[model samples]
Target: MKKAILYLVDEAGVIQGVQLSAELWKKAEKVVLPLLEEPESQELQREGPLKDFQTLMEYWDFTYPYSPRVRCPHCGASCEDWRTDEKHTFILNTANLGGLLVFHCTRCGTTIRHKHFKDHMSIEHTIPAKYKKS
Candidate 1:
């Protein structure tokens, strides 16, 4: 299995950052098989064949279809309230950053300055609006 870099972007044109791994990409058919069986997923297929994992993943990486929503660091709403229209970008660079990890939240406008995976997770998995002041 070759390593692959997965980039996740949310709606509002935010690039969450590239995820580096040595895993082969999963096929959309494989990923959506279970979903297609569900009533809600079936309804989605009526519009057309539900997007495959590759397409969905691509859209997530470069398009605005993905939403910038992370797990709520506090209440854990796991809903839209935790989502934001703000855009962010994540990239893998070795020259300046000198690391294989970096990410930010466009919704909250926070950046993970440290060059470490732990920092990225801290920022990515933070509670929604917890660090943001009204």
Candidate 2:
């Protein structure tokens, strides 16, 4: 049987998208990234799944197989779809913190943080983002 349905969850730790394997993700990267960065495609506004993919690509730095197994902690939702920048979703990029992948769970309002360790990865912390008072 297949190990797990690969998912690109949203900030809510909810399965927002599905990804079978790194190979498939790579294929998507090739098709999506160029369009977002290409000068000719500037007029095209990226929305829906494309925006989520773009955010993930930017956060992962085009790395493949970010996590062999992606499962939500709160809801235990497997990889489904990648949702981003919605009223209930937000992906915070923490590259400075050792390439941390910070996802805010809009459903439960939980912040899930994961760190990359070579071929494998693990959840490092799950906390709220520190905001500054201006």
Candidate 3:
């Protein structure tokens, strides 16, 4: 009987796999089929909330339609009391600003702005209004 191979490759191009007899491959496929059809969100839920620094840094570039979990970078406070300010920039009868979503953290009064781009966004941090920068 012929055999089937299942290969798993990582980002670094390392590969691993198993070659199984036709009969065993059928059984393995039955077990792996259900997992392949599972929703991606279900898998992410099992991993819990992602708190990696790179994830947070890439928040503005998130392709998901929903808002990401945002917290005060300084005080680590929740988003409940944060104030949102959407700024539109205009230049001599032309609107140049794509969009800016500014979240003012109430706990520590830090201002964070996410600038919208054509396909993604960029984040900016500003000093508290009360503090003077020399």
Candidate 4:
């Protein structure tokens, strides 16, 4: 099925939204479905069937397929949409007994930090300023 992924962008133009394709969706299910079939997972589902992809995406970060391009936080450019290779740096810290996530905007040379990289994407990167304060 044709899927339109939605992206949230900053004024500088970085990716903030995610939509999955039928292929990606199926892939996600492949990973999650097996887990859901497990006795433990089935027990958890006693509350209800897991109904959304976001839950699987959040639970299966390492396996979730991500696109190569990111939005430029300074220029509002859809880096992947334009197929540009401008380097955006991602800092993942799983060392030194400290946890931090950092994203560097290549277009405007801005660095953003968050307690968690995934949180940074879901909360800071994808959210527009207009909606950030709210």
Q: Report the number of the highest-TM-score candidate.
A: 2
Candidate 3 lDDT over residue span 81-125, tens digit each: 221322111001111233455555443556666565656767666
**Model 2, residue 61: displacement in angstroms?**
9.2
Most accurate candidate by lDDT: 2
**Position 128, candidate 4: lDDT:** 32
lDDT of 4: 0.40
Candidate 1 lDDT (Cα, whole model)? 0.34
RMSD of each: 22.1, 18.9, 18.6, 21.0
**Model 2 per-residue lDDT tens digits across residues 54-97:** 45556665344654233447544334333422232333433332
lDDT for every model?
0.34, 0.49, 0.45, 0.40
Cα TM-score per model: 0.18, 0.35, 0.33, 0.26
Residue 96 error, candidate 3, Å: 10
Name the weakest run of 10 consecutive residues (lDDT summed) in model 3: 87-96
Ranking of candidates on lDDT, top first: 2, 3, 4, 1
The lDDT of model 2 is 0.49
Candidate 2 worst ten-residue window by lDDT: 37-46
